[model samples]
Structure formats: C-alpha cells, structure tokens
Target: MLESLLDGIFNGISIGSVLLLAALGLAIVFGLMGVINMAHGELMMLGAYTTFVVQNGFKALGAPWSDFYIFFALIAAFIVTALVGLLLERGVVRYLYGRPLETLLATWGVSLILQQFIRSVSWQFAAGVGVFCLLFFGALWLISRRPDFEQIRGKAIAIMLPLSGAISLVVSNLLGQTYKFAVTLPWFGTQGVDVTAPKWLRGGLPLGGYQLPYTRVFIIALTILCLFAVFWFLNRTVWGLRIRAVTQNRSMSACLGIPTQKVDALTFAIGSGLAGVAGCAVSLLGSVSSNTGQSYIVDTFMVVVIGGVGKLVGSIVAAATIGIISYVVGSNALAPLVEFSPFLQGLLEFFATASMAKVFVFALIVIFLQFRPAGLFPQKGRTVDA
Candidate 1:
C-alpha cells in the first residue's frame, strides 16, 4: 500500500511537470504581453514535429548516436518554434495589440491555420483564403463603386494587399489541412511518429523496497532546470530588466527609449520557445503528433488561470496541487472507499473513470474560483487594471 501511494505521487509529479511547463509559457505571454495567444499550442506542435524530425535524422544516420538525439532535438525544437513565433508576432499579433477580443479571434484563426497546415487542405484553409480574397477584392469593389483611382482610398488597397497575404497564408494553411500537407522535407515525415524515451530513462530505481521510474525522475529534474533557468534569465539579465520594464508599463518604457515593440516580439518568441521545450519533454513520454499540443493546451490554460496569471511560483504550486489531487482522485487507490457506504461507492465509482475525473476537477476549480476570484496569486498594479 505504501509503495502504491509513493508511485501515485511520483506519477502526479510527472504530470505536474508537464503542466508547469505549459503554464509557464502561457503565464509569460499572457502576463507580460497581455496577449492570450490561442496559437501557443500550435507552437508546441511545431516543437514536437522538430523532435520527430531530429529523431528520424539520427535514425537515418544509423547506430549509437541515435540514442543521444534527444538533446539536439530539444534545441532544434526551441529554435524552430521561437523563429515561427517571431514571424507570428511581426505579421499578425503586433497589429492586434490592445484589442484583446480581436487578438483572441485572430490568434484562434492562426491556430486553425497551423492545424490545417499540418493535417492538409481543410475548410479552415478555404475560410482563411476566402476571408483574405474578400478583404482584398472588397476594397477594389468599393473603389470601383466610387470610381476614383487617385483618391486616398484607391491606394489603400495596395497597403491592404500586403496584410491580405498574411490572412491568405493563414487561411490557405487551414484549407490545406483537409488534404494533409505533403510537403515533407528532410527529417520530418508527413505524419505522426512514435517516440520512446532513451534507455537511460526507461527503467526504474529501487528505493527502500519500492521503485520509482527513471522517466519520472528525469521529468522532475528537467522541470527544476527549466525553473532555474527562467528565474535566472528574468532576474539576472539586462534583457530581462527591459522585459520587466515593458511588462510593468509599455508606454513608460517606450518613453524611456526602450524598444517596446522589439521587447514584445522577443517576449512572445521566448514564451513560444518555452512551450516548444515543453513539447520536446512531452515527446519523451508519449507519441509525437500534430495534435499532441492540443491535448494539454486547455489544461495549461486552467493552470495559469488557477495559479494566478504571471506568477511563476503560483503556477508551480497550482500545477503540483492540481496534478496530485486529480491523479489521486482518479486512481484506484480510493477503491477501499467502496466498502464504506453505497453512496460513497457510487460517487467514487463515477469519478474513477478518466472523463469524470476531469469534469470533477474543473467543477472544483469553478467552485474554488467563486471564493477567490483573483486566483492563487494576483498580479499588482497595471496587470490588475488590465
């Protein structure tokens, strides 16, 4: 019984690590930029794909080196996703700043586009393309109705065209999801791949007559490293100072000659890169797929929300608490309760199922929020106002 309890706690910590990782990125972007990035999960998907590519590259190279590919895969995933994040920020996200609703809608569209791009030509692409063409030609149609090419409005279409391409790219990628994009380059195949943990992390460790899986230990260690690195970067670096300044007050930062726009882009990229790292860590535990990131997106959001947005320590605490509670309630460790009473038996039986466990968890969160609406750790000053 003691072994079972210990094992369950270990499993909970593993789950918590992933939640912490996913929530960290969400906290950074949502807190600092005030942009609820709907496409964050897709960024994670990009990282998983990067790992898949790296793993395959090593496989093709043949033999012993393949075992060590995870290290390279982690770096590649962060870089690729970070670059993509920069493009996203410059191209679409920057314009939508200050308009939270618009930004949410726009990022949601971006997420659809990315998913479509991965899966192939789908309705999302068609809708995206249609929206672009409509906006593009809609301007011309208006100009034709007015019949003034030299008018200030006539040249507006030219400016709009460049913006239209961004929309079209987003939409086309969505539509392409219906057909599943076949533009396979080197390393990354056109489909999902199974990824197994390295041999070093595959076994178990004996402890006082009980054993703990090495994979779980690796997860805990990785989470610690990530937390330490983020803590150091945010506190010890000049760029981190600039970022904190911007987050505290964008207008004041700009007035002080800080490149607020650059900071925004970099922050988004770093946040996305963190998500990418989360994806790589996840790939070690499960199969890598286009949809892999989607599974954790909502849960991660809940973590950020419950932990109090932008609070790192709060996120850590919330993730661990939630992970443990959810795992414990969902596991059969509570089976002994069935012998106590019929009512308790039925209740336990209901929650023992995986789906109900989530519903129960969310319901608890809802109830908890009613008492403490600001979450575990609310941000002060401007963030509170925002």
Candidate 2:
C-alpha cells in the first residue's frame, strides 16, 4: 500500500511538471498582456503535433534519431508557435488589446480556424526516404532567421529558460551518484533489472524490500531544480524584473523605454517555448496526439487562476495543490464509489467512460470563481490597470 502511494505521488509530480509548463505561458500572456487567450490551449496542441511529426519523421527516414527527436521537436514547436503567436499579436491581438470583449471573441474565432486547419491536414504523407530531409533543413533555416532580440533583458531570459532545465538534469545526476540511486526498467520476465541510470551512476541502493528506481530519484531532483530555477528567474534576473514590470504597467514601461512591443513578442515566445518543453516531457509518458493539449487545458488554466494572476509563486503553489488534490480525488475518492455503488456506480461509470472528470473540474472552477471574483491571489489595487 505504501509503495502504491509512493507511485501515485511520483505520477502526480510528473503530471504537475507538464501542467506547470503549459500554465507558465498562459499566466504570462494573460497576466502580462491582459489578454485572455482562448487559443492558448491550441498553441499547446501545435506543440504536441510538432512532437508527433518529428517522431514520425524519424521513423520514415529510418534514422536512429527517435530519442533525439524530442529535442528537435522542442525547438521546432517553439519556433513555429512563437512565430504564429507573434503574427497573432501583431495582426489581431494587438489591435484588440484594449477591447477585452472583442479580443475574446476574435481569438475564439482564431482558435476555431486553427482547429479546422489541423483537422483538414490530418492525412499522412508517405514520401520517399529522404524526401523530408530538405524540408527539415528548411524549417531549421526558418527558425534561425528570426530577428535578434532588441532588449537585453529579453535575450537573457530566453537563454536562461533552457539553461535551467539543463542545470536541473545535471543536479539530478549528481545527487543520484551521492545516494547510489539508479533507475531501472524491468525487462521481459528476467530476474535481473535493466539499469538505466545516467552513465556516472549505475548502482542501486536497496530500501525496504525493493530497489528504488534511479529514474524516480532523477525526477525528484529535477523537479526541485526546476522549482528553484523558476524562483530565481522570477526574483533575481533582470529580464524577470522587466517581465514583472510589463505585467504591471505596459504603457508605463513603454514610456520608460522598455520596447513594449518587443517585450510582448518575447514574453509570448518564452511562454510558448516552455509549453514546447512540457510537450516533450509528455511524450515520454504516453503517445503524442494532435489533441493532447485539449486534455489539460481546463486543469492548467484552473491552476493559473487558483494560483492568482501574474504571480509565479502562486502558480507553483496552485500547481502542487491541484496536482495532489486531483490525483487523490480522481483516483481514490471517485474510483471506488464508481466501482461499488450499483446505480450510482452505473451513473459514474458512464461519466467516467466519457472522461467527464475534466468537465467536472471545469465546472468546479466556475463555481469557485463566483465566490472569489479576483481568484485566489489576485493582484490587489490593479484590476483597473489593464
């Protein structure tokens, strides 16, 4: 039972990491730009699709590049979505910025357009072995051709985001070595384990009756490292300072020589990049799909709202809280009731079959909003600023 509980906790943390990545972007766009991006979820969908494409590309090319495709997809999704986001901001969102209602309606329309486009292009292409090699090169060229960052602080944050993830991996490896921890996957029906720890740390330490997986150790360490990096970026960096500035007062920052337009574009890009990384992480756990982002949209936004607007700290708190609550409620509280209650069980069984847990959670957020109008940690005295 204790082992099962530990497994659940591990799963919850992994899931929360993905939510944190998705919400990080939404929080920045919504809080900083004061634009409620209804299509934010679709941007995430694009990222997941990018992953799917890259994975398929590897298979089609017969390249030994499956594992590396995750890295490529992260870069590709960020570039594609960031460009899309910039165009949306410049062409549509910018004009409707001050008009909140129109912005909402227009973006909702944009979302539908994107969804239909994805649906229309759902057919698979089976070209010759190396047909897409040039296309991949072209995509890389397009990404690199983006204009240089005008703001120093913006450039700094752009560099730091990925660096933070790398640093986390390193720290996780180091800690694994000191503790003699390793991650192993069971192979076939063999008694021996498949040691999958980083090259530097290959041995395992026994705990109780079972050997703790080194992957779990790495995950825990990485999670802590990501948490630290997030805190530091928000609190210690100059770009972080600028991000906070714009979130509070865009016009004022523009007047103070902040290159408000550039800031907006970069902020959107950084947020989108974070989402791309999250999608890559998701691919590790399950099959990637065109609609993967749709599954997490409601829950991720709830974390943003429940964490309060424009506050990174709030996001962290909200993510952890919602992750624990949802996992506990969804798996333990609801599962047994549906299993044992006959009539009630049948009703819940039907709902469960339809994946209504997502809808139920969305409804709960709406109900909660009615009681706390500004959300859990709303920015006080600044409601009228946007």
RMSD of each: 6.7, 14.6
Q: Candidate 1, residues 53-111: lDDT per residue as tens digits?
A: 78888989877878888888889988998998899999999998888899899998888
Candidate with top TM-score is: 1
Question: In model 2, where do residues sit more than 4 Å from their true spots?
Answer: 60-64, 122-236, 333-371
- The Cα local distance difference test for each model comes to 0.80, 0.61
Where does candidate 1 have its weakest 10-residue lDDT segment?
Answer: 181-190
| lDDT tens readout by residue for model 2, 234-273 | 6798877877787778789888988877777777666666
Estimate candidate 1's alpha-carbon lDDT, on a 0 to 1 scale. 0.80
Q: List the residue pairs that clash in candidate 2.
A: 182-214, 183-214, 183-215
For candidate 1, what is the TM-score?
0.81
**All candidates' TM-scores?**
0.81, 0.65
